[model samples]
Target: MAESTPGFELPLLLFAGFRSIVDQLHAELARQGHPDVRPAHGFAMQAIGRDGATASELGRRLGVSKQAAGKTADRLAALGYAVRVDDPADARRKVIRLTPHGYDVLARSAAVFEELRTAWAERLGEERLRQLEADLRTMAPPSGFRLDVAGWFGA
Candidate 1:
């Protein structure tokens, strides 16, 4: 007998399935009264926190068009989650900084993520959770593989 390819392990399908589950989780967040924030907002928040960055810089980091990043910034600004200030180093550029409310929201989101992760671990059991984590880490590219629980659980 020949070695068989594992069924349902196609990378794209796996990613899509995970995405659906994430969508459900986000829906729960929204139901819990989180302000209808998109995945893009979460990505933008992470980028801004990592680097005191300009919108164009965020666009570059996210592999999105500058206009798209600007639009995202606009939404954040309108929601009072961020403000764009003239960059001191470069007059031509502006940097996006989180507002107090944004920081609060981010902190709450962190707590929620921790709670969810703990619940998930409880459901999966320690050994199975560890195995699932290891498998996912192996699948990720070397450069993208972040071993930190924060990165794994996306807080």
Candidate 2:
């Protein structure tokens, strides 16, 4: 009979795999001129989206407090990744929008992720990688991706 894998190793392996990918991504990002970007920033930017969002709206989307979201927006603005502009419809409120630099970082990140996936496929064999992805999809929830992972992890 085949030996069964330890249940305890499953979550560890999964987390390690994720960490490895993220670490590599950040390293590449730094080399590509975005040394200030962090994992949480990516989640925050996704919450901000193309149309931009108010601090409260961003907070809700990211499952973080309004204060936390505001801080993130401040950091992004400082880094030149985002800007806070007057809301057109609501003169009392401000909206945070991704700057061109922010969009460039996101685009670079996507390309880097694709390169990483291709490397993984080459290392594991394309078929095996595809099978692994299929298995993960089958095991994972179908509710779609969430931008709140950073907040979830902090909690």
Candidate 3:
């Protein structure tokens, strides 16, 4: 038998695991009447919950360009999941915040995530999940990581 390369196997397995979890989450979301929700939207929701961010700040944090972040914000706004108000500090920039609906969606999603996480912990044992997290963190790039949509589905 040959040794696998240092970088390939871990990420492959990590993504496979994420796919399983996300599929389960989507099913749960659909049952809860949020069929239109997406992974990117969930990430944006969390970012809004954490802090009021400018689109450029979101772009920097998400490792995307400002234009890409603005597009995401626009979509979220169209869905009534976020609001953009003129930045007090900078007239040219807009501050992004969660609307009431956005917060409600995020709260529901968090509950679902917690339920799933607890079930997984019970099934796999908390120690095992912790170990897996540590191993994956060790393998990740220092700067951070991004899921490229173009490569994600072989598109």
Give lDDT per model, in order: 0.71, 0.95, 0.77
Pairs in clash, predicted candidate 1: none
Instruction: Judge candidate 1 against the unseen true structure and give its global Cα lDDT, from 0 to 1.
Output: 0.71
Please give the lDDT score at residue 38 for candidate 1.
67
The candidate scoring highest on TM-score is 2
Runs with alpha carbons beyond 4 Å of true place in candidate 1: 1-9, 31-33, 145-155
Off by over 4 Å in 2: none
Decide which is better by lDDT, 2 or 3.
2
Best by lDDT: 2
Give one digit per residue, the lDDT tens place, for model 3 in 32-120.
Answer: 87777788887766655556789877776665677877888898899888889988888998898888878877778778878888888
After superposing candidate 3, which stretches have Cα over 4 Å from the reference?
A: 1-7, 137-155
lDDT of 1 by residue, 31-142 (tens): 7666567666777777777345797777776667678778888998887878899889889989998887677667766776767667768988978978987998897888
TM-score of each: 0.77, 0.96, 0.76
Tens-place lDDT per residue, model 2, 1-155, is 99999999999999999999999999999999999899999989989999999999999899889999999999999999999999999899999999999999999999999999999999999999999999999998898778888778876
lDDT of 3 at 28: 89
Q: Assess candidate 2 and give its lDDT.
A: 0.95
Error of 1 at 64 (Å): 0.5
